[model samples]
Target: MSIKIKDFWKAGVVCICVLMLSSCDKWVNDTELPDNTIDESQLNSIAMLGRIEKGAYIPGPVIAGVWRAGATSAADLLVASGAISDEIVPTAVPNSPFYKELDEDKLTPDNTSLFSVWSNIQNYRARAEDAILNAGSLAPADEDGVKVKQAALVNARLHAGYAWMLLADYFSVTNTSHSIYADHKELSHQEAYGKAKAYWEQAIPTASDAEKRLLHSLLAKMGIHTGNYSLAVQYINQSFGASENFSFLNTVGTVSNGFFNALNVNSRDAAVDPTLVVALKTTADKARNPVVKAAKGHWSLTLLKERDPLVVSDYEEMQLIRAELIIRGLLTGNATDLVNSVVVKYDATGLSNFPAGPALTLNDIVSIRRIFLSWRGTRLIDLRRFNIDGDLIPGFTQRKWQWIGVPEIETQK
Candidate 1:
């Protein structure tokens, strides 16, 4: 059989078995499940487990109703968060009313956008949790295939932890209870952060070099938020030797990058803040500016073509974290040298026309960070952090978020 057919056949078989075994519900509806469901006994093979892992990264149809591929991944959530924070603006009404609400900072319980974000976040979390929970339960076909289980467990934990962190970061009202089979109660933001930290820490031991780097970056943010600058610094130091940029693969069948989709394909929304685009252009910051375009009076991003990769975390973020720590006196380093190092490095890496001779201020670190991490969804948090520290950007708008409580869908339990 062709690879496509083979993949389809395997996915179909796995879906049937998983649904029957896991108690299909709202996300994985039983009525829609394939009739040719396989028996649970057939899942012991390593090949079948590999198929399950592959399916975990595939966009929904298994869990969430919409098959957004990668759009609903981190970038999409970033879009929602950006929209809520004034980093993105609405030109036309979005399909999801919740996004409109987010743009207005007035989300309601019944908003579909809220449910979509909540459901997608919870669905990813459930899949990750399932992989971790089932890691030891499944019997490998071969006696010495222990590596497969460990790999799967580590991958699942990494995704689960990050998903949990995303939930804590974006969702005002958090839910720790996720699973189609059982109901879970809601968690406060602090409780949610605890869950995120636990999963991240659990995954760190067996994570690959690159995965460990990504986790360190995330844990740094966690530490900073929890007022443990020491822990944040330690995590950054451990993973600082190399630049590990975690990007969302925007291949065909996997969704396109969210920014490109929303601003270019959808055209309903664009970058609202002109100053952001202006800064990138004037400062010779080619890394962020060229991707921004203006047409018909709408400013949209063209960073990724159809399948261009979207960077989620990288060296730039690591440097910013280090810079922030230095500014706060958490890490022992000259803040100016650290910030200048970032400038010098970026200049060396194709920013030849970098405006020269300005000593790096703490605001410069934050501003450079803003330019480098633009459209990746870290803008709002950076603004918030800096604003809290009285390092306000001259023309930045501070968005106020009102938490939308747990939706009725989850409350049905």
Candidate 2:
């Protein structure tokens, strides 16, 4: 009986096929609906716009179950930059060839880890652009929708500006040619910075009050980086109040904090530089420089947690920028008082102000930034800016590289 039932089902399928063949023209004439597709028009919803905005910050699975570059690129930058500079040192560990490459300053264009960071930075910019476009295309029907659309556009622009700024800061330019994207078009470092400045300037009009202040701080930082001191001063005046202690952080979500995972949590691919540890031990700014010994007995920082936000810009950084300008004769102020103010706020209670003595040299500002801005992804730039090389600290080796080389993939035609 079971066999008979199977035969009956097979016969029924054959009959249906024969009937469809007999009416093939009619069947073919009937319209076929779209299968498993979503049109661009469908993405105009507020929820979709919010998601596009979030994508600007979060890493997407670019490599299909193999790697998530965008999520960890910033962390990679921190580790590589710190190891090359004086902030940290690489440890002997499994699956850490990239760390060794950066630590030894033997980077090649083929370095996949560094390439991932490069690609992800570009990805962030692309995603931000997408958010801006999508937000502009959307028409808000209510106040809530308007807020969401504006937030998406403003955040997108801010993040895009920062992405461009990072590219200009960390990557090298050769004879005014720096390949930035898959398209193989080359841009000089200054051109890259100019792009960042444009995005920031565009964002100011629609930004919320707090966001405006943040944008001003970012513009000031860009100005300082590009040697536009007058512009830096103008934005610094609008960025933060002296007592604000304001900081703009890239909030972590779904992705873990890169520095914590690399240096302290998952693997000890790097540890706080021994020189920094010794420096911290004698200094009263322990509050600002928290440290703990790793499993290998090397020091690691506790400045970040698994999901804590990464510092983007801050009041202290602005103050330091001003202090640098003062030392360079571009600004008028007591650089020591500016530096001392930060020291007093962060220094352990009852520690005297940054020794009131000789005028603060650029090197002194570098030293202060080395301590206060530890693990903030600025050390390498500082080293480059000050032309610091030939043994950063006692027993440390001479510096080998100034900026990370452009990834090989970008240079390919």
Candidate 2: how large is its RMSD?
12.6
Report the C-alpha lDDT of model 1 over 40-80, residue by residue, as the tens digit: 44443343334334424222222221112223557658777
lDDT of each: 0.57, 0.64
The residue pairs in collision within model 2 are none
Q: Which stretches of candidate 1 lie over 4 Å from their true place?
A: 1-45, 51-71, 92-98, 139-144, 174-183, 240-243, 252-254, 291-293, 340-362, 386-408, 411-413
Clashing pairs in 1: 70-255
Q: Evaluate residue 73 in candidate 2 and report its C-alpha lDDT on the 0 to 100 scale.
A: 53
Candidate 2 C-alpha lDDT tens digits along 1-413: 11132233233323333332343333223234333222333333455444223333221111110112234555556656777777777775637667666667777778777767776666555555555676788788876667677766777677667767777777773313543442345677777888888988898998867778889988887787676888898888788665443223334235676677667734657777777777664345567778887676777778777776555557888888889989989889989888877777765463646767889998888788888877777877777666666245422234445667777666655
Candidate 2 stretches greater than 4 Å from native? 1-41, 50-72, 141-143, 173-179, 242-254, 348-352, 390-400
TM-scores of the candidates are 0.75, 0.78
